[model samples]
Target chain A: MATFIGMPAFPEASARAVGDAQLRHNLRKATHTIRARRAAVVAEQPDWAGLRAAGAAIKDRTLRHLDVYLERLESAVTAAGGHVHWAEDAAEADRIVVDLVRATGETEVVKVKSMATQEIDLNAALAAAGIRAYETDLAELIVQLGDDLPSHILVPAIHRNRAEIREIFSGRMASWGRPAPEGLTDDPRALAEAARLHLRERFLRAKVGISGANFAVAETGTLVVLESEGNGRMCVTLPETLISVVGIEKIVPTWRDLEVFLQLLPRSSTGERMNPYTSMWTGATEGQEFHLVLVDNGRTSVLADRVGRQALRCIRCSACLNVCPVYERAGGHAYGSVYPGPIGAILTPQLRGLTGPLEESLPYASTLCGACYDVCPVAINIPEVLLDLRAKVVAGDHRAERLAMGAARRVLDHPKWLALAQRSVGRLRRWTPRHLPGPLSAWSDTREVPVPPRESFRDWWARRAGEEGGR
Target chain B: MSSRDRILARVRAALADVPRTETPEDVEVPRAYDRSRSGPDVVELLIDRLVDYRAVVREVTDVVAAVADALARRGAHRVAAPAGVPAAWLGGVQAVRDDPALSAADLDALDGVVTGCAVAVAETGTIVLDCAEDQGRRALTLIPDYHLCVVRRDRIVRTVPEALTRLDPSRPQTWISGPSATSDIELDRVEGVHGPRTLEVLITPAL
Candidate 1:
């Protein structure tokens, strides 16, 4: 799969989800627990708001001067004995990663869970080139064994529970060379153990490792991975060739900018002070070859937008996902793309563009609850960004959408016109059925349309203001 | 797109619409590091915070006995340490395992876990768990109840961002700012909800 770029629209994919009760149950339970924890811990610190502001500001400043900082980062990485490659998108990144692993003459590479690699569909690409890519991260391993795409950002397999996990591990782990023991149970600990035993073999044997960074330091040319598991350590060090794929947005201007994010990310995400594992590698070490692919893949297009540009600041901490009520109920798979949750809502549209069905519908996924913005470690105003994208989609081709807004503006510009509009709406409110006709019926299929008011709010407001004036 | 293509477009666009370069706008920031809140002070705060979370922090002069005593106190039956761990750090522990190749069964047999660090941050009162050297694999520290981490004072930094600067780009390095903890029941706090219950940090003045 070349990333789900050419997939059907989100509404089409979500229609499939409307019938699946299992996904809803898993998503609801997991998201609520994590959501409650994030709120409680976030409330502990009074400086959270300040920290968020600083994080947002720092990222804004860094992205503003990204050209200068990225060049500096490339130079710093090279001076540290690392090689840097610029990738336009998934294909370029895949080509570079495959070439690096091939140069080592190693057919097998162990991977640290990387969303960028997922964005490029790296494993499938590697398999096509006659190489095997093993996922060492526990959540990713389950996803790999199941031959399923990742539905969540932080926990890729959030859609699947322990029972589903056992089947994947027991049935498929061995075909990949590490089989689960017979009579595997659905206990998490047991499943984790099976994964551990299976992954340990590759960790000791792999000569190449692939990964993505949570943050990349421009001044130092350092790449950082904040994880709860130790598999990342096993894969990065054991491999002779370490290849890191990073988005241009992952950069922080300096160490000072890095601190604000580290605090904000952990607390908002796992509700911990810091992740259990934070890995940083500057370049090649002890005769290892280090290759960095700085992926642009629609990033420049995102950066070009005045409103949507804030998305490029994401650290991928997934704090927003843990907090989003919509994501909790709907689940990650409903979004039908790689980057799911709130980040996915805005980022997917910008990354791949709204050409596909899912892309156009993604910007509408949110309730604009503002919780995603509140918990965003980087302080991306998700609601504002979501609305901005909505305006782009609905009002798209300013000429076309402008026609609607213009008609709306004209009716609002005249009192008589407004009154006539109210009468028509009031009449329809009584006679019209709750469900609209045609594809528009999907809205009422899931929810009831509120009947229009007896009188326009403008008339009510004028009446109230007149009373106040008389007083 | 290649750098030339991207930058060339920017340059061409600048020829007409956007400024080639605007007057550099400098936003004012705090001039001085707050003396009351330094990296060392953050580390101190982190220690108090960790203690509040119920994990014990011990400042150690000799790491050998610190590791030995910590494990002895915890009554670890099977101990898993990072592969690059110095033999001296073991301090006569009979069952310590150094193989990165240890199966989960082998890891489970160990009474506890120990690992060396790539760096430590005093400001955050956190230890950087880079899977470097002897820091047994991340799971080694995570699966076991007692996490005995050896931190060198010099590795410590003042803030989370500063701490990130010291990390690598590729490998997974887990950051343990404090023992793992969570709270439920109207803000009733619980320790070791998922990860290590007892986090013993033996901070040494030097490696």
Candidate 2:
């Protein structure tokens, strides 16, 4: 599987991101715009809190009886003329997809914007096996053409402006399929037209389509995809064979449950009461073959965690990303995973396990300000999970920090020792240096070291008490 | 064990701490959302919402004139309609009747598609097509650059829940809010993507 191998730890990548003036500008502009819009639409729903609670409850019920639901879903899909496959991990899922595409004797497949495919690096896997996957979503197309990693969940090319998109479309479209028309301007509509013409041919001719579902209804065996561009509609409908890789946690118990998500997702993600399009198909359509791959790629492990399991309720709305101050400054690439922002901080470590420096740094990537919790449509308590992961991290490694914390705990445990230490520090205030050496310097790297006061509060209190006694 | 059995086993083990006897019905889901309100209020709200998405909405007594005017305004010369659509609905505009065997390229060659919708949501201004006889296939509304859908005001529901109850889950459904749009470019909504560039919905009086 293609992984975020050899990626730098969060701090290093974030430091570089903070220095990129253009990236910071783009992140601020895009995030702020979506944030305000989300707030407005959310305020319109008088029972938003009730809806969120219900959404969370529905997911919890599905997950608690996941095994039973999976069986029911498999049978439901089978009855609907769709084949269901189970994948233990990314490798298995990729193998299933490649084999399915190979069976059709097709070398190229068009894809909708799917986080699952990105997680498994399915396109790269297909490429290794001599198959090409074309991303048809407008933002995804920009990312694929630019040979860049997706920086945002909803809008992958959020970091790029209109001018950059035009350049990418102009320079890259020819190599893929249709070339951009000459004199293509940076206007968004013009760029969209160029893409529509370019991908329309691919959509019309492609034999296979690959996608990820926003919600998969177990009762009806229906897969639902919510998108703006008709690209998703084209990919799913116009193809001869369709393969969907869905996370196990995406299942909702009944078709009626779509009411909660259909309400929460658009408002929280795109700030629209309803997105431009939502396509729901039970299984195989009349002319198309269908395959459903239920992927457990680290999701089963995510489910095993008690406190951490709530992360499974995430609908991938990216509301947390829009409200994250850390994400705004550090940018998405700094997270080193397809999943980024507040959700990524807790989710990545749990899914991939905290074995690497990148995963380890992810837990500490948040200020725990709880803004992510406020905007989450599912109401996933991101800060609670972040702190839980942090405790796990602290329990495992960071011997130096642990030792330092232990020493501070000793002083804090004894009031007399703390007062004595404070008095000595007060006496040395005049001679204290502004900068420190060693690991403590990491703290002062971007901040000034505070100066110690001339007198201890304890001494001042004692002196005042003696004066009162004398009087 | 097979991957399927292994995954199920894993899921079972993961939830070992929770009682296995608990059923999905035991969980309480609050449906406090407003699913009430109907009549003229719902139809007006649908129009207001559709206008917000830049969809050209019109209230008309004569569907034929409305459809004809929509095609004329867009200078659409070649239009398509499903065979089941009432001929009187497309009285003035000449429409190429859709057949099941119509290739995607054939549909793409047309200027626009006009049809009736299965249902319309008043709160969200969404028109859902269930591939019914009049609505034709999913590609009919998608491949064309222009889409003119005639929605009966009686089909307009107050909320998403109300609309869901009116439709069936077994059939393939396409929910359209406006013309194809994308917020991909700096989160700024640019309408007209791969779907129809222009969406004109003619609202007929409640039956």
Candidate 3:
């Protein structure tokens, strides 16, 4: 249940990630494979671009009028025999879930892998309250057992290779519930079998199931979870009491709107035309008690910013992460949030605010490559948002940077000042070192310092024009 | 103000720059994605997609023998089927009729479950169960190690929207494309994680 507070800045963390050969190898292999598959399936659709446009439009429409749709969803969920609770922040959301679980007098709960729950650190919250929440998704189970944070959105343990997973399962399975079979191997199927045996007992006996929604239909009051494993089915169906904590932005206007997202999300994230299973339930079932927690948790502030609110439209597809070059090199850990990569580059800053060094550095974690925007099912224009956040960072704090930029702006805005500065640099070109020292060493460490080009382009142009005129 | 009202106020305040008169419909969504391209060939596409997902698909003239044979092949002797399903469907197999009173352990002990689906989507090879009479409770299909689903050919739809129209929004729905699977470990797809490890689909003929 920890937050990404006090994390080291992006440069420091990414420096280490860039050095880890194994991490880089795993990331490159996984992202490139998924990226190629996504490109192939997305190409199969004749109207993928249209669908992407519509997905963005629908999300924009919903976000602008979220108050109305959320109200509609709450009423609809209530009419369907469910309770709706509103939380302004993470602590309140966690409290509401803990109390709901406590009311059922249940000490254990099964969880579907949910980014919202992860964002709020719900499992850790539950653990502190003397309740153990078992993660049933194979990736999440690996993350939980290994006592690690989820690095990827869809495959949380994307950083772990099969051999490492075998070790994790073999070493950690018994303490949880069932033990891994003798001599468990690194084969994917065998590992999956070991997890299945371990989590089956917990899923069957658990009275409470906790989850997050991919989309919450305001019209039908249905929450949809698209997943690859049957863990979602087991948790959502078998539990007597189900509690789902979803972000306020997850609401869509109607069931028909799902057609647009269903087409866009699967092809973008898992690179499948459709995932293995999609579970949709309108509020509670006949026998199960249902509770829907709508969490604001800085969402209201996010919605307030007209330019930055587009991050809210994300379906948690992780396509942006797969296509991002920086994400490939730096891996998911550098962004220092539950969300990492291109979306996180813009999102974590806005959600947490650029108040800390780590949060501020996140905005610069991108090269503004626009690859994320190209593949985004919702067309978030991540580069647009990144540049916008960078402007905010520049406008705020950083006295040295502000002064330096001001001096540069003065020279660039005036022709004479710029010429004088360029000539001075040209005259000193012979004295210039190939590398710089002190704080500027970071810039010149891996790059050759330019020799001021002998003369500024402006002087060369003027001289050539004069010579031509004389001739 | 309470968190609800405060949150709503914040939302309104956040959108201060947005004109107050704008409605959700003001943002026009281009619905030009090909929803009309589906046809009868979608059925074959459905079978191909299901096969790609590695589900055992049997186009059988005799439903009973096909289901029984598939169950036998999976070594599932004590199978479970919804009471509403025709008794003849599992004619020669040892069938445990679905009971709401059965616990998870009770259902887990069974070798597999056989049930009819409400509808199947051709485009995605998805079989949707809406907790219908024949479909039984969700646990019937989920808890067991193997699931032998009977999808009638006529009940197959060309697209997801068509399947959504056939379903009752009130009933809980599980849209299963294949057996339970995961791409969690280094993005390699592995079947049989949580739900039925093996999904055997019996497509009854159009007649």
Off by over 4 Å in 2: A1-3, A430-448, A456-471, B37-40
Q: Candidate 3 on B61-150: residue-level lDDT in tens?
A: 899888878877888899888878889987888888876456778788999888999999898889999988898988888888888899
TM-score of 3: 0.97
Q: Is candidate 1 or 3 superior in TM-score?
A: 3
Cα lDDT computed for each candidate against the true fold: 0.72, 0.91, 0.88
- State which docking tier applies to candidate 2: high
Pairs with steric clashes in candidate 2: none
On residues A333-429, what C-alpha lDDT tens digit does candidate 2 reach at each position?
9999999999999999999999899999998899999999999988899999988988888789877577778999999899999899999999998
Clashes of 1: 41
User: What are the per-residue Cα lDDT tens digits for candidate 3 across A1-471?
Assistant: 435667799998898989999999999999999999999999988788888888999999999899899999999999999999999999999999999999999999999999999888898789999999999989999988988878888888999999999999989888888899999999998999898889877888889999899999999899999998889988888889999999999999998888888888888999998899999999778588999999998888888887899999999899999989999999888889899999988888888888899998998888887999989999898999988888898789766567778899999999999999999999998999977866556557656997787889999999999999999
How are the candidates ranked when ordered by lDDT, highest leading?
2, 3, 1
TM-scores of the candidates are 0.81, 0.97, 0.97
For the second chain of model 2, what is the TM-score against the true structure's chain B?
0.95
- The CAPRI class of candidate 1 is incorrect
What DockQ does each listed candidate score?
0.22, 0.83, 0.81
Rate residue B49 of model 1 by lDDT. Answer: 59
